[model samples]
Target chain A: MVWALALASLALVSPARQAGVMRGGAAAPSFVNAAVARAPRDGAPRVHMASCAKLTEAAALLDSVDVFIFDCDGVIWKGDSLIEGVPAVLDMLRKAGKRIFFVTNNSTKSRKGYVGKFTSLGLSVEPEEIFSSSFAAAAYMEQIKFKASGKKVYVVGEVGIQEELDLIGVPHIGGPADAGAQIELKNGGMVHHDPDVGAVIVGFDRYINYYKIQYAQLCINENPGCLFVATNLDAVTHLTDAQEWAGNGAMVGAIKGCTKREPVLVGKPSPLMIDYIVDKYKIASRNRICMVGDRLDTDILFGRDNGLRTCLTLSGVTTEAKLLSQENQIAPDYYVGSIAEFAGAGVKA
Target chain B: MVWALALASLALVSPARQAGVMRGGAAAPSFVNAAVARAPRDGAPRVHMASCAKLTEAAALLDSVDVFIFDCDGVIWKGDSLIEGVPAVLDMLRKAGKRIFFVTNNSTKSRKGYVGKFTSLGLSVEPEEIFSSSFAAAAYMEQIKFKASGKKVYVVGEVGIQEELDLIGVPHIGGPADAGAQIELKNGGMVHHDPDVGAVIVGFDRYINYYKIQYAQLCINENPGCLFVATNLDAVTHLTDAQEWAGNGAMVGAIKGCTKREPVLVGKPSPLMIDYIVDKYKIASRNRICMVGDRLDTDILFGRDNGLRTCLTLSGVTTEAKLLSQENQIAPDYYVGSIAEFAGAGVKA
Candidate 1:
């Protein structure tokens, strides 16, 4: 039952609420008050909810926004396959002079890696138009002027985080290289810690091992002024459409258990990525930006918590029945069968 | 702060209280009420606590016990080297006609493995006198008639567990073999699970990796009636005198994070080990049994929760300062600088 409550809070609660409940000492972002004020609280009437599948409604939704932030996995594609009509819808939005940005919580790939993915999916995208959680983590360190601290980062993630840190010229250790490490109990389980590790960044790591978990915990728990950062806490992730694999949350949980510390989440619903986007791109108005995605928890919650209008598409994890369930706390502004409806709306118009 | 509270509870709280707090649905063992009735409650004056280092008190303690249960790692030895006067203390206890049993929460080694270590330390001990958590796990399975269910076990531990399971003729899979297994995201992160795995057993593992964690989670979360069992939840363990390594709790935490399930603990303070020991050995009258150890949480709490007299040593993880701290909740009936004090007491006599 506690797990259920945790899951519910993770999936439906706003980032501010999550910050208060999960990360005890984290301060809510400045933009949270405005977003909280605009969204309907639990037990409130659902009068603002609408279906944007119809041509008139969809076109009205499209016309209201100058910028569109899309979640990649479920919105534009699932796994390696592109979603139907996504490219056409993107072209139409571009023709209408709408700026587009691909925002993803997937930290397994960097911005350049995502460019390769986008190109392979037949979508033209620039590195600047992508904001992965890996990029957010790197940008956060730069924002805090971490390089001047004269301490390195201890990574418990994959190549994406390593590449992003490399891009920013931030020194780090212990990622894929530590995957094959084995604790030799015969020689005595004396694990050495690097005292210069001032921060630990955890993300989705397929090669996660006990050595990395122990090393990261040592840095976070023992190093002075050390930071614990999580790229995302998504409980499960889609590496393929076949099934959900254990997400980075599992990796983070291991260290959290050992160190007994809460990580500063830099992924979706944390406002870190969106704030970075807003400051970097100098986005004029939050009211003119719309977030389109297929997940109620990460994508929709991220949008709602950052003062952006949100549209829920049923092409990925969430479904219409789930959205309409009595216990559902999150209410998206608009719902469609898929993002393909946008192309249909253009054609009808 | 929560971790501190959890640690305090783990080390000091009686099993009944731990059951009520941590394992919500489980019922306290029949011996719990008597144990709770005998121990001093928090906020009460610890009047029964005594220093057994004096010859008078030590001789009185030695005179009252019919059986002695000693915690291995911290009590008899730390890693490899035996503590000073341990052999003489054991010889004295044996000559006094006191039955001795070596009870350990270290699931990394089975009873047979312990015999070799004891012999190497120049102490003669029979396998029947050892009660490792690995043996308790196997015994528990037999007690519950798990074999009749025609289901195999999935192990997330080392060879100790495997050896114990083999002794019981229980079929199992996934241990050292799964250590090197990698998740091939290139082939789609679709991990197949064996439908026959009806239980998962976790313990301190050096070669812990993502594949074992993911597989165990799948079995516990998806498979029908799949049981999750943990050998122990010790936060930190000593492999040598150098420093503490992350214990089995970290390994269990990874799976717990993903599965959101509580495990049936089979180690110290769980009553499972003591219950099995009592049942198999036909030990009568718990009143005369003395539990001697260096740790307060597992060893002393195990004794207190099982209605046995408890003695704490300052030779391992716990110190006298901690025992006398204002925040201390659990109180052992007797305290000593080390078991070597027993030898001093004998010499004085």
Candidate 2:
């Protein structure tokens, strides 16, 4: 079978596998909470149940789990600051000697920035405790042994990516003038005007205009073998003012959705991030680990896809309404109104 | 039976005794055209082939079909005055004694503005030929006998909606504060502020800020019995710069999507417009009517849902890729490269 069950916590797995947990009861630890099927209505899309009890039950099963994974945006904070009681919850977790990690798919900020943010927000967090998609992307380039000593790779993202590439000593170029650099490279021809582009790496470039999208598409099309990497796969970025703007995820999706080729993801729930966290921390049994997040598509999905206990908070992206509607999607092992509730009540094993 | 085949057409008609026509066999004098299903695809949404094919073929069936319905924004000119041979096609149709009816769900522009736009585009059209959501909404108020004689009916749309209420002699209040003389009423007691508002009329408001949406929601929540009317149901609006902007449909959907109450639609394919057109023009039979448009959900669906022919054009919103993917949602009767092709090739009937 193309699908197989992993005998571990649902929180540490991939997003796709995490959504598949509602199938067999015998495979799981126990069927503590199950969503009920709703009756169909006339002229309305059929909706399925996503119960809060299911998340609570999952939390109960992974009481003393070791590792803790957290998503930054929509989980802890919308952008810049932390949600209510986030600092206190983290302090309690640290006091309890629980191993905590900040696993974010956002490729914009560097680890130092994340550490700075946490410190500024009155939370004790170190640079080593943070893991971003930019780090994973740079590592992928290193693993592939990509040659970029003299040639440039078009950078399309933020400071985190630039920092990662700088750490790896990789040279990259970007701009409207450098747009035709890829086509020039294909014909064994070096660009006479600005000839130094070897590959194209698409990241979250906030100041995106029409010329940028067109140039990026052209560059990628010209050089088929050129490296193309997308930092993360988030369609919309939630902000504080309830203003939702389309993120790089949608652009990446438009490009990858149009083109059938899957880009190598390097963020949380990609198995890459989980593996990095597990191996680096030397966390011995994967079953002892638990991942807490607010978004189902990213956080709970990351846990379920991996082998960690997944706890979903109602304070973020997927609300009670969204959860109640999502039937077969990622079901969290524990459902808490806020992270503070989990820390205070202590998940019972 | 709930679903049975008609003996004359062998077409599957619902138990409601909806009007249907016979397919190919004996050529009846009244027969305009026949609809057939396109080849099926795996993992595709299920669209009744007749639904997609009937509208396009309907154009050929009529003997001088009155009121040629054209969906605006996406179907005709999007954003600015940029369209692919639409103006020329309209000119040709007008010369051939076809009464061009600009039927749109867009409640942004007034009839005078639309008439002016046509004149500027070299297409001689009158204000009476335009049928917009505002006009349909006015008709609905009259039909429902909504009594709002001195009471303030909060208008959340453009000047066109205000103009429609003026024509119908409905005492209305509320417009942008910037319009000193036009400001008949202040913000009502809704999320935005205006209290004491009797009803809510949702129109195409481009200057929608957070305050506006909040106000609208607040108003609706305050008055459960307040009437909610949406001019159209378009998901995305295509702009001249090849950009997809949020149309009133999404806003309408957001309000409805957030609130469980569904708004009454006053635009095309709702049977209201078709009835108004037929009654106003005194069209002998519905069989002679054909709906020509670029979008599938609104334009083509109008024909399919109402037992008329629909023609899908590539010049507007629904492209070939969208058509192939949107098989399950809505389908057009005939696929044409552009209106130019449809107009150039005379109706075979």
Candidate 3:
């Protein structure tokens, strides 16, 4: 009964049903390119939002999906604390035979750390159940069989990236050192660099400055063969409803400008993060998967690009006006005010 | 006379004099455009270096100019210390009726501060004798009569820019605060903003961080009419032979990426800095002025752009190989091993 209700929620919004766009199976196209994602796909408008405000409308969409992917910062939690009713809604999803995974562009945390946070918040989580940009970067390096055996990693980020690298036995430098160990410049002098640094990884670095970036250039600019990788390309991090923070993209962009090159960004919308998840956890069907988040381009667009359904939550970012905006090309299959809307309302007994 | 010998130096390298290109008078062109600077102007090859290395050859080139504009960092001093034989050469120029003005893109010091430095380096300089990028920015603001009455300037630079603003009584905020007074980010939280921040000036700040850049975005992005200005676009600040520090351009570029705008750059290669000088000094003939420096693009290209004859010295950033390289579109009228070569060694007593 609950499955039928969930199908109704999805049917209320999905353009796939209207235009017969859900050409599932082997015929489902691979990732859509930028040009295709810009305009409507399969004769459907490029963007859409759920029409019903009732919990049952959104719950029907949730019940149809077997796996749920979430963006952390603006969706599940505000900052260090968990969002209200998020745990209960997640618990209900789990009881209904759903696979849950947390995908974040916040390159500041490792997957293990995210799992720990989930456990602390009274939600069950396995290490594989969370995918962070940091881990995505780590996994990417592993997949490529990165030849950083003897060379050190020059990091322009926090400790989260370092932890992931260490797990894979990668040596890194230039991250957050002990307190008061900040490098001082003599007027306009360059920082001393290590000759063995073969790769440069940039994430969310709070202490980013002239010396760190100059050192990164010394590695990449000096050596043309060096690897230039960044965790995410988020423009800004929405902290709360009224406040925002500069994301890892700013630091990454600065270095890119200095070196006159672009980095391989390993976050949402890249397909690298989601690709790693799908390859590891074999889901039943692509249409039965959903990504829920508070942003458009990174979350909903990422879902649309990868042939997965998406739900937009208004509890954090992407206000209703923004969702309905004509300027937005990113669209989702279902919508809810918060995950709290799904708690104890439409789930089966 | 020294004038005849100096003309000989110009005769040695002057495509202008050789090819009858010295078509001076009111008929000479105004400022050269960016595309013109990128390629050879007036059927001239893209790049030319001064041929004579002897002091007599350099002095011959020097004698043709009355006002000589010198770039300080590489042309005069290596860092805090003066280049070998610089003070004596400057003195010789002053005695030869040459109006010696030190024009530095180093936004690290104000004009008065430069005077102190010149005095300490055994070279006498009045405040009018030195034109720094800091003073140029201040002068430009004054020219526009920035109506910042009861408004504060958001400074994302060091003391040099602040000092110039203070001299003009333009109240500013966000420079070197007390030591250990760095602002920390609470995830995506916002910093309190000033209601009266009318402009944002960017320079090299050692203490730049997330909070600082975010605060900058708030001022520029939130206020559509705010002025965004930068000192220079130098990719790296030359400190020593093998070292370089990050320049103001990196900081400016980040804010540009965030706000999707460009800042009005007020340094070398930008006619604004030199325009202020030409207007203030009221020089008679454009051909009577010679811009002398160590770098090609910033100093030599700057000279070419402003209709001034240019000279290059090998005391700093541009190596002889780089100067002679065909990749360079910037050409100079004369070149020497050092400005010291133009002292009494080659000039008439």
Candidate 4:
């Protein structure tokens, strides 16, 4: 009986049904009108405006979406502890036949690693349902035919980037192994650049040191046609809920400063991950997809720039004042107190 | 007899004598006319043009200077081996009674350490005559009355910064000790920042690691009114004469990325070092001081920006093609094949 009810809910939120409701504005839900009224029209100058979807309009907003993409950190959980009602809301979305994807700019984890994290958090997730920045980096390299170049990639990151590159059959060097490496300047030691290194990928690395930075810069600045790639440029990352630590941007900036060159960003707000998802999953319509995240710059801007509906959650890095601040140029289409508001219970706010 | 000849040479190149020559343009040496003709006039559009001081005119150029400031690394020596004729040039300059100061942006060594390098290189140098960036950082802190606040500084650099701070009686922490420190994310490790830190100094450090980057960023971002100071932002440095390695800019860039803050630069291209030198040594005139270096951006730009005569040498990181390129905006007053040409021997070029 539960399966039957789930099937019925799935049919009700089908992509075709959602597309029909979107095109026929007269038949659209009240929340659609509320969101569309504040959103900029096509070809119009984009203004930062978002509607606070009330408890009564929450169901209507969720009913209008056929696909849902979520940012893992801050949205799903803060560090190791999962946010309240996350499991229930995820289960509810699954039952409603909403296609879900876990997208994260945290390049410290691979898709398989994310699956493990999700499982440990008491949420069921498959590797295919997750798209980490590390995976995006690998996918980008694959798209560029880097594997055919027969040259190894110089990594200034962690094991996650190495694993992703290994998955794609692209050889790499200089990751966590360089954590203890020292440049004996007292003994007149020098870092030698490998001629076979064709690319350097930077990510959040706890083991980042001067040696890795020197190697990455040497490859990027000296090697011919060497590509400099960054998994993400997040200013700070949540190692734990207690404090924010230096993010991948710190590592990438070191190389950027030395090389005086910018890297090819392949994380959120770049449109590369969404493009990869669209091609791989055959996503029908962008209008029927909703991107739920915590950050305005990375998550909300990522969705808005990719023509997807965006919902901002206040349970993460952003606060209510920050969301409503005039300095915030990128606004979402709708906002809720948290993703916990979608638990089907009465809205907490 | 040597003292009498030195006194005579000193009177011949006195400030007043050089000033008279400058005012009496028609009677000035040929090299002076050559330099003035190519140099941009006082209110004219500045163009990148530098005349190669011929072998015949080297003596006249040397005689026109009351004070000589030399950059150590590429201008004086490559690594351990001193450049040919460096000692002879120093002897000749001293015999000519010119005030000489060894100004270096390499923050890896303190003034005392520089004296040791000079002694080992078979050159006579006093600690008071050397103005390293490390000393400049300490001087800057002293000028800002940082010690009165009773707050300690957090260092993300080598022992040079520490030694200078020690010389100034300022408290500091986190240098080579943090090099072995690791952030064990798997064990849920966190970096605890000290609350007593009022400033963070970044410089060229072979021991630079993510722990230092994180601690520095936390102090700069979370601590109120904390200062971010950089010894230098040199893109690259000569660990040896063979190749260029990452400089302090790489370490500074990491903290800047995470904190999103600009550092108070105390090294070359910043007037802090020259200002400290002027205040301490009481330099009479900027025009009578010749700043000799190899790099156009840091050394030449530093001299030019400070109203001192600039001379570029070709023995360091910069090539003649780079100096003459259309994109090069900062030009020296004169160019030479190398500092070796100033040895009073015939110019090799």
DockQ values per model: 0.40, 0.03, 0.25, 0.37
Comparing 1 with 3 on lDDT, the higher-scoring candidate is 1
Expressed as tens digits, the lDDT of each residue in A1-349 for candidate 2 is: 1011113333454453444444223344354455545554556555443323544343444355566777777667765556787776676666666788888877777787677777776777888888888777777778777754465667666677778777888876553243222312121322222235555566554443223433444455444565568777764454332433344554453334222345667775678878877887888866667777877877877777676766788766667777655243456656677776655434342
C-alpha RMSD (angstroms) for model 2: 10.8
Steric overlap count per candidate: 1, 46, 4, 0
Q: Which residue pairs of candidate 1 clash?
A: B11-B297
Better of 1 and 3 by TM-score: 1
Which regions in candidate 4 have their CA more than 4 angstroms from the true location? A1-56, A186-188, A345-349, B1-29, B32-56, B186-188, B345-349
Models ranked on DockQ: 1, 4, 3, 2
How much is A298 displaced in model 2, in angstroms? 6.2
Residue lDDT tens for model 1, B26-67: 132221211222244566543322212112246656665689
Docking class for model 4 is acceptable
Task: Note the chain A TM-score of all models in turn.
Answer: 0.84, 0.76, 0.81, 0.85
Error of 2 at B56 (Å): 14
| Top-scoring candidate (DockQ) | 1
lDDT of 3 at B185: 45
lDDT (CA) per prediction: 0.77, 0.59, 0.70, 0.79
Candidate 1 lDDT over residue span A1-349, tens digit each: 3234434554664554443222111132221211211243466543322212212246666666788999988788887778898889999888878889998889989999999999987899999999999998998899899999988999988889999999999999998899788766654556788999999999988888878877886787679889999998876767777666677878887887777688898999899888887887899877678888887888888887787777788888787878766456665656677888887556544
Compose the digit string of candidate 4's lDDT tens values, residues A238-287.
Answer: 88876778888899889988888999999998999998888888988888
- DockQ, candidate 2, vs. native dimer: 0.03
Per-residue CA lDDT of model 2 for B164-275, tens digit only, reads: 8777777666545312221112112112345666567777554433334434555665555677778876654543334444456544643452233578888875888878
